[model samples]
Target: MFEKRELAREHLKFENNLFAQRLVPWPLLNAPFEGSWCVIAPGTASTPHAHHEYEIFIAMKGKARLETGGKSIDFNVGDIVHFTPGTDHSIVNDGTEPFEMYSVWWDAPMAENFLKKHVATEN
Candidate 1:
């Protein structure tokens, strides 16, 4: 079983100058992980937030800065970042172009358990 979604048809939610679209866990897909697509306008940033789920962000376009753990990291197109559960983070777009990224998140415990089982089987 697989699913497909067209980006052009997806509705984007707006906050300030930031645009976001929920891609996974939608009505048709009851996935354990959640996913989203975001575009941050120049000089804008996503709200700093944290949750119980581990998160991965894959930069799709432009340059930006990732603020987390009291430090700022330079992020560019094609860069990928990971944040452990409950780590506060946000993406700041200081460049003239929109910072585009895809985000995927899932429960930390669930992921750990899955990895443990797979590793145990391999061992």
Candidate 2:
């Protein structure tokens, strides 16, 4: 079986953070391994929060300041970052260009709960 989904850029909001096309749905993937394409618009920053699951962040384009545990680091194209459970993190656009990324949440339920609870909020 095969499934294809056409994804477009949209706004993703969690609490007070704003994300563009963040936490995209991956219906094709099996459970316990769901993922989504994440995007951060220019001059935008995500809400600093922590998750109960492990997440892998892949940078597709542009650069941004990745903040974790009150520490900020610059990330650019082809960069990969990983966040474990209880690690507070957020991404902020440090340049004038859009930052694109694809992230995967190993814990499907945790990711779904967060995305469903706090997506579609406008900045």
> What are the models' TM-scores?
0.78, 0.71
In order, what lDDT does every prediction score? 0.83, 0.72
Worst 10 residues of 2 by lDDT: 14-23
Q: What number of backbone clashes does candidate 2 have, counting pairs of residues 3 or more apart or in separate chains?
A: 1
- Using lDDT as the measure, the top candidate is 1
Candidate of highest TM-score: 1
lDDT of 1 by residue, 5-123 (tens): 87752478885357988774455454557788889989899999888888999999999999999999999988999999899999999889989999999995656655776676679
Where does candidate 1 stray beyond 4 Å? 15-17, 108-123
List the pairs of residues colliding in candidate 1. Answer: none
User: Candidate 1 clash total?
Assistant: 0
Which parts of model 2 are misplaced by more than 4 Å? 10-16, 20-28, 108-123
Error of 2 at 103 (Å): 1.5
Query: What local lDDT score does residue 22 receive in model 1, on the 0 to 100 scale?
Result: 77
Whole-model alpha-carbon lDDT for candidate 1: 0.83
